[model samples]
Target: MKHKYAESDGTTRHVWDVERIWKLAEDLEPFEIHIEEIRGLDSVTWFYNGDEPTVRSVSRHAGRILNADTSLPPILTEDFRVFDGMHRIARHLMEGTSRILVKKFSTNPEPDLIEKL
Candidate 1:
């Protein structure tokens, strides 16, 4: 997304920015997760494995979900690969909710790849 920032010259410049990310919380699109879809999907987070989410974290997020807090950012994915927010999704599944909220990133790039650079 592009955002306009005011310049000292009394002009504004539109540039690529995180406005899209900022919108995810409020503009969640229904993300369908079939039981089969969760199987063998890859995690983008460096420390994440396919293991079940911890009860503590899941419980905490369940509260947020229950409270209807849009502050809970949507899980990001691309091409059926989960890069973040796995815990939130797990909590939804545990609650027997078939659909979750998500924001899909088109780049679908590995963040760790930048650190290696």
Candidate 2:
């Protein structure tokens, strides 16, 4: 299965196999969710500020989120910005579900920072 993702600029597109994509998701460890606040979809407006998330992207993710098979959790930055699991987020917005579970990272860590911690 082929998956396509458009860059925020809307000038470039990325294509990958579905298996590879899911494999990458599986590789990601579930980070600890320490933040207590439940943020709404608006909290991460930056993600869709431009043409970052097209309709196709949202629909595709909505399907994944609607399905209960994948256990992938949402990931967020320290300031509560979402980077991964945008599909699940879209699903929440579509279903009028205001709350989501996300693991916040202090920063986009480098190898050195990850190793030090």
Q: What are the RMSD figures for all models against the true structure?
A: 11.7, 8.8
| C-alpha root-mean-square deviation, candidate 2 | 8.8
**How many residue pairs clash (N, CA or C atoms closer than 3 angstroms) in each of the candidate models, in the order given?**
0, 0
List TM-score per model, in order.
0.39, 0.40
Off by over 4 Å in 2: 1-65, 68-71, 111-117
Most lDDT-accurate candidate: 2
User: What tens-digit string does per-residue lDDT give for candidate 1 at 1-117?
Assistant: 243111122353322233443444245554544633553334333223364567876566567556553335444544544434455555555568665556565543322212111
The alpha-carbon deviation from the true structure for residue 67 of candidate 2, after best TM-score superposition, in angstroms, is: 3.8
Cα lDDT tens digits, model 2, 40-67, are 4554443463746678876665566687
Clashing pairs in 1: none
**CA lDDT of 74 in candidate 2?**
68
Model 1: lowest-lDDT 10 consecutive positions: 108-117
Task: Give the residue spans of candidate 1 off by over 4 A.
Answer: 1-73, 110-117
